[model samples]
Target: MDYLMCHIEKEFFGTTFEGIPIYQYTLVNKNGAMVKIITYGAIVRELWVPGRSGTLFDVVLGFDSLQEYEEKNASYFFGAIVGRYANRIAGGSFKIDGVTYQLALNDGDRPNALHGGVKGFYTRVFKAIPMKTPKGPSLVLKYLSHDGEEGYPGNLDVTVIYTLTNENELKIEYRATTDKPTVVNLTHHSYFNLSGDGTILDHEIMINADHYTPVDENLIPTGEISSVEGTPYDLRSFKRLEDAIEPLKDTPTRGFDINYVLNGKDGELKLAAVLKSKKTSVRMEVYTTEPGLQFYTGNFLDVKGKGGKYYSPYSGLCLEAQHFPDSPNHSNFPSTILRPGEEYRQITVYKFSMEG
Candidate 1:
């Protein structure tokens, strides 16, 4: 496959505690799909794709300035890597191999630990190596996690490759190895708004999931593998996000923020979910080799982002593929433990297409 690379001068919130320069790089594909990524947490600054009318728009919600990201305390993550453990860990604690571990709590008012605590991967600067691969120009990010950092055992070396394939697929390949047993679950947290503006409530979404894990008021799973047969959680078929979100306005978070068990026999690469914006005619199909997919509707984005834009609730949505939340605490959930000599690998593809 043929590819081209370019860099655009852009400043973002500095990565240092004292505030420094934040540089970003923009990579564009032959089809004109562009992805702007920064070294800070390897966050994706912008993702521009062709619309139905041959125009381009930044479909992903992000800040245009670093100060906005720092001031608003944005929870969008905005194309950042979430790790050590993704999603919520109930009670901010879990047990593995008869050993209990306590994690740092950072879920606002909730007691559970979320997205790897206050200073997760999203706040760190990763070492980026731009490579010219046979497939295309890719950016490989490497980060080392010390033992007991964020209360996770074992020293882990993680490598995440972000590749823009010629087929219009933004492929994320995650690989990690640990010297000791550790709970590892990682996924990209990008709030996608294919229409580029307005709320994503009208976006249509479909997940190839027959069962979903029910959650309590705190947003932690109830450990029950309930079928999406008759509830509003049902998305086994195509449905508008607004259709399901409007009725769920009373729930905590007031929008879709639940994890669905991707239905397809064991955990394999299957169609996880498909989202389409009728306004832009841009559609995204997600495929992943993970056990579950967390569909978050950007419910907590009530702060100002880049360019002084205040992102309201449901401004964007995310479909994160990973192990179930609190899997380390629930014995019935799929295993998230990575032992020595075992390779932890996960592949997620976001294929983009448009209709006239």
Candidate 2:
């Protein structure tokens, strides 16, 4: 694990749907923490960090090859950047500036548009720039979405930077601007299993949220911000996911896939969540500037990932920091609108460590 250079390397990942070339960028920090990101969809294919025993393990679940990522239909998002709008949009329609826009109904039988109507940022190739930052290695990804590309208004220009600092922090900074009013809720979809090969059910979870947005059967927010007082959604203190989710295992929701309203100022980066694997003692602290965090246990993960690994339900978990789900349709929730002349910026940092 010698990282004297802390170099940023690149290699060919795969081609796009249109047969365009795509590249993978590898960033290694001074402490030997490594991360691999592909230009196609700006996907984070692998992230390796040291465990308590000084063993490096890939914490994020992803396909071994880009071909698998391209051919798979049920992505579960894996380790990609999902955007335009992250969660479900009710009825696949929303009103902006007194005009109603209809999107493609991609979520079957749900009457909603899931993850930006099928062709979201997670499926598109992006322009990447590798760089050497003052603290460590970094890469910047840029993409532009034309007006009405996915039945959404505005020509949006977006830039996201992934920086690996010497202190073992994977910092993600997102900035965007639009020409017309549109809904924008960008979030990273990374299924994390800190123990590398085991289920995340034994992982301890802690969320800094006093309330959460309840959802319907279709997973759309009901526009009510209810307190997490006595419900199973309470993760204010550290609790094993297995114990926290056992009560809801028989319900319609099945498991944890709800959005918790972060307790803090919306625009300031604050501690949102903390996840630790009891087996490996690998800890990840999530800090974000967003208003909410979507905590999803990989309840539907049935894909085969890297090294011929078959991922089962609850194999991994996701802590997606973003705005509330269906924020555009719910006027009571925090707004996800990006108006003309206004800039959209959010920062989320995943700092990793080992518990002694």
Candidate 3:
């Protein structure tokens, strides 16, 4: 198949250390929007979208080769799917039906678990199937997590679909089922810089959240659901990212790394955030079915990205939509527990456009 103009194209990416063959799927839309997804980690390797000048620019930050991901993704996450649980779990421990499960202490200070312990969905090679749909091109990725893997219960079968629609929307749908009770909070970890280069401090942003979860020094939720009023976390209206970060200069959160309680029902998709870059005039609107959105600025980034470009702190930002962190321990938070015969589902869309 001639892939130059094809809506969907698949090619061999690379082989994993386990001798597993991985493939990359490229999905192109009628609007010149394109997305490259790889079976390894079910990651979005690149995203090219039209800007105000009608030029397509790759807007996400990632590496050029599979080896780079294999070596660097453990710290960066990049555009991979983070799963089982997305954020920090207090003391790397949680209880299910009065039984405590201990996970790896992989986060800061070695007191909490981050993104499903040492091995997460981000490290797995998903089985990929590329197909054409009426809406556009879609790639389905599936992975199975065995019981006791990463100290989590049950054999969980997870399926994630990445669809590039005609409207320039990168849609992600996640579904899972477990044989026994388990807690799950999956989210996509994509660091986006709409301008294609430089720090993301100038990006204009807006989040549809009235309250946010307060966190401690460990970045674990303190069980307080506080209002965003009179706080830098308030982004109910459009505000420049630099301005948003200014108020937190002297605070523990030098930059945003907190979860916002989104203003919408939990089960239905709704607008979560909007980000725009004046340099490129590209606008990205995020919609999700989850009740919480983790807005994190790349505060510790200091690495070379694709094309050997040096990425400094705040080079990109991540808006992770998922259930609240440490949900299993917080009785007041939304439940993330999945039981036998029950299904876990979530959808998040990153829709793009250009402003003249």
Please give the clash total of every predicted structure, in order: 3, 0, 0
Q: Pick the lDDT winner.
A: 3
**Candidate 2 Cα lDDT to native:** 0.90
Per residue, candidate 1 scores C-alpha lDDT tens digits across 77-115 of: 777889888899989898778898999888878889999
Better of 2 and 3 by lDDT: 3
Full candidate order by lDDT, most accurate first? 3, 2, 1
Q: Model 1: how far is 194 from its true place, Å?
A: 0.4
Off by over 4 Å in 1: 4-15, 18-22, 71-74, 265-267
TM-score of 2: 0.97
lDDT of 3: 0.92
Off by over 4 Å in 3: 1-6
lDDT string, candidate 2, 270-341, tens digits: 999999987888999999999999999987778788898999989999999999988888888889999989
lDDT value, residue 134 of candidate 3: 73
True-structure RMSD, every candidate: 2.1, 1.8, 2.0
Report the C-alpha lDDT of model 3 over 1-356, residue by residue, as the tens digit: 22333388889999888888889999997777999999989999999999977999898999888888888888889999998899889988989999999988998664899998788889999998887777878899999999999999999999999988888899999999999899999999999999999989999999999999999888889999999999989999999999999988677667999999999899999999999999999999999999999999988888888999998989999999999999999999999999999999999999999976
